[model samples]
Target: MILAKKKQRDFHQLSTPWNVVFNLFAGIFAFLCVFPFLFVVIISLTDEGTLAREGYRLIPSEWSFEAYKYVFQTGDTLLRSYGVTIFVTVVGTIISLLFIAFYSYAISRKSFKYRNFFSFFAFFTMLFNGGLVPTYIVVTQLLGLKDTIWSLILPLAVNAFYIMILRTFYSTSVPDAIIESGKIDGAGEFGTFIRLVLPLSLPGLATIALFSTLGYWNDWFNALLYIDNPNLVPLQSMLMRIETNLQFILQNSQNSSLGLEALRNMPQDTSRMAMVVLATGPIIFAYPFFQRYFIQGLTVGAVKE
Candidate 1:
């Protein structure tokens, strides 16, 4: 009865006029946030002639699919790069989440014999690193991961910062009594972690998963350094190469009036927007699936005695 009364009291605290003002401002804020991407989509659909003649517009007088058409022209290469990127993102995010969870969970436990030592071990790496040349030699020479997908995955798989975040989250958000109870129920370390701890830690795990997913999706430098095979090139690397080649073509074009007009007709600006849409659309859609867990993870053990 008190809980229901508290809920009712809170609901009435807003007042109708205040609620209207809050919602009005929130709607405007949301529109402002979303308008840039909408503008990009409109630009991608605008005809090259219209774009060149007029500046960017919310509604173009003419529309064309030339940008998308050009992107799709390399159908086989596009599909292959897309497959490689998806595979890398999925596999990398899973591996990253598992490693982070285990390492963080291990270090967060006060009962662990080497908790402080392992905690310092991860922290020490955050302060210093063997420079790129030496690190490169290790991966390429010692590990023989060069020109392989493992090179991409292994390079970025473990982040010290992510381990720290998960460790803090686990410490503050998981109560000791619960683990004792699980132990009392005859659960082992792995069993208690899987059955009790993981269920309560979804929000923290979800946050890390989203970060890892974005890191893998947008990575091109790793592909540039480690992947030499054409077939192993991921989407971002392929897109970078496409943009570079396009710029080269534009630079070497004829320098005359007709040539300038031809340049105007080419899908430079529009193609960029098309690429932006293609690259970002999937990740944008993915954010909503993880949104609920990100903040709610903070509240996990708040009510515990």
Candidate 2:
């Protein structure tokens, strides 16, 4: 009875300090992550004149939603860009996940004759690539993907690192006994993969899917390089244009009948903040939904058996 009480006391003593330290670090990191977003939100809602008078602050001196109102005034441009981003993210993630999953599965199979050779081929691309100009020419001139949504989706559809990670996961986690059992049950190679392998690899798939979706969603480079159509511009690129180019903002502001003078007087800085918040809204919302899956997937795939 005395020993048990001592053990219990020691456990409580150890846990108390650890819990305090953990909570302290977690709170600090959480504040660091959330502070910038809070500042952005506060600035976005601040009156333009107030922002011009005083730079950004955690709390706005005068609150107003004019920037958001101005953004939604036309609404079509923003809405269209959002639609394009969504379409590309969905389509690109699906294509990338399918290709990576199939290729990884093939490479993970020990009996596959050319697995090593194919793995080397895929891995080699990561080390060296045909440089930017040639790649651009091939994608734009040869493939004729310029100015289309395909320009955004096709070029970045396959990522080498993701494939490697998935391959490692399949090789480490999946048991050879299961495959042999499936074969004994009269399942063909394709059927075994479809029924047994893919189900077990969901964590790896979820991890890669999140990576692909983020890549597709945040990508402005492909659009900047190959896409010339204003209608096909993704939200990030549109936000970039609106924020960096005063003339474009002025032109957009003109459509509201506030005139150049009033727009100049308005909180240009606050509007930039508002535009950033608007552009990132979808990602902010979608991230939490996939976050649990992402964490689980990465943990499983990263562990070697």
Candidate 3:
């Protein structure tokens, strides 16, 4: 009894120092990660004149919502872009997750005769591809997806790395016993997966969902390359256009009478930071919702049994 008590006491004493060190490191890491975002928010709120004269500050002497006001002044266009982006993100994420989950599960099954072939096929994609021009030609000329919403949705729907992660997770976390029992109970393959496998793989699903959300949200290059219609432009693309227009106006200041004033009055610095805040605002709220699963999902396929 005494020896057990001493062992318990010694374990706690040793663990206490490690706990303190971990907390300190974690605190520092989190602050380092979050401080830039906080600085962006502060800079966005700072008055343009003060921002120019005094530079960035943690606590600005003067505050203004002029940058936000400027952005929303063109709210109709911005709102339309918001709608486009939201639609793409929601729809794309759903389809991509479904494809990833189903495909991964299929390849993970030991009974599937062609599992090795399919696995190699998926892995081959990660190693080599047809390159940009050929892909562009196929998407534009052959498939005729250019300037359409499908162009955005289809291209990014299948990610090789994510598929492998899901496959490995399903293989490791999902028990063959449960699968056998389902077979014995007269459950179909699809039914067994939907009922049992999916529920058990929530952690991996949530992690991939978060990844897909961010990818869809931040993607502007796709819209830039494939889309010609202004109505179909996503938020990030629209913001890029705004920045481009500002630069254009500044560059041609000497040519137009109004250009000088436009250059002088452009909310250049503050507006950039404001755009960051706006783009990231929704995603920031989303992180906490997925935080629980993220830690769990990262361990996918790492531990056997």
Candidate 4:
């Protein structure tokens, strides 16, 4: 009994120090992570004039809805951009998930003789690529994807990392007995995949879908590279234009007595912060819905088979 009590005391002594250190580290990291977002939120609500005069602060000296009002005054542009973003997110996520699921499922099946060959073919692109110029030419000239929404959707639809994650999940989580049972039930290859395999892989699919959707939502590179039409601009690209180039505001602010120079000198710093909030709003709002799936799927996929 004395020996057991000594061991228990030692264990508690060691664990107490370690727990304290862990809690201290975790508290600091959590504060660091949340601080920037809190700052942005505070700044977005701050009066532009106040922010310009006082600079940034954790607490706003003067609060105003002017920034939000400016963003929503017309409402049409924001609405249209939201629609474009939604369309891209939904369509891109669906197409990407489908292709990735089918490909991963194929590669996971041991009976598929050419699985490794196909996987290597896919994996090879990750290490080497046809450089930017050639890729641009192929996407624009050969595929004729330039100046179109498809330009954004097609190029990023299949991420190698996402495919690999899905493949790993399938190989480990899915039992061979289940596939054999499906086969014995006279389920066709495609049917079994669509009916059985897909249902069981919901967590993995949900994880990849959220990631792909966020990618499509945040993508401005494809728009900057290929798209020129204002009508086709996704929310992120539109936000980029609004933030970087003061010309859009100047052009629209024609009704105001302020000249281009004065408008250019307006509290643009605060407006830029406001625009950042606007650009990221939807994704941030939608994130919690899939956050659980993302954590679970990534954790499961990261474990060695």
Best by TM-score: 1
lDDT string for model 3 (107-161, tens) is: 9999999999999999999999999899899989999999999888889999989
Whole-model Cα lDDT per candidate? 0.91, 0.85, 0.90, 0.83
Per-residue lDDT for 192-225 in model 1, tens only? Answer: 9999999988999999999999999999998988
Misplaced by over 4 Å in model 4 are: 1-32, 70-75, 247-265, 295-305
TM-score of every model versus the real structure: 0.92, 0.84, 0.90, 0.80
Better of 2 and 4 by TM-score: 2
Candidate 1 deviant stretches above 4 angstroms: 1-12, 255-265, 298-305
Order of all candidates by lDDT, from best down to worst?
1, 3, 2, 4
Give lDDT tens digits, candidate 4, residues 219-242.
Answer: 988888998887788888887766
What C-alpha lDDT, on a 0 to 100 scale, does residue 62 get in candidate 1? 97
Q: Residue 138 of candidate 2: its Cα lDDT?
A: 97
Indicate the residue-level lDDT of 93 in model 2.
93
What 10-residue stretch in candidate 3 is worst by lDDT?
296-305
- lDDT per residue (tens digit) for residues 21-70 in model 2: 99999999999998888788888999988877787776767899988886
Better of 3 and 4 by lDDT: 3
Provide the lDDT at 36 for model 3.
95
> Which pairs clash in model 3?
none
Error of 4 at 264 (Å): 7.7
Instruction: State the lDDT at 43 in candidate 3.
Output: 94
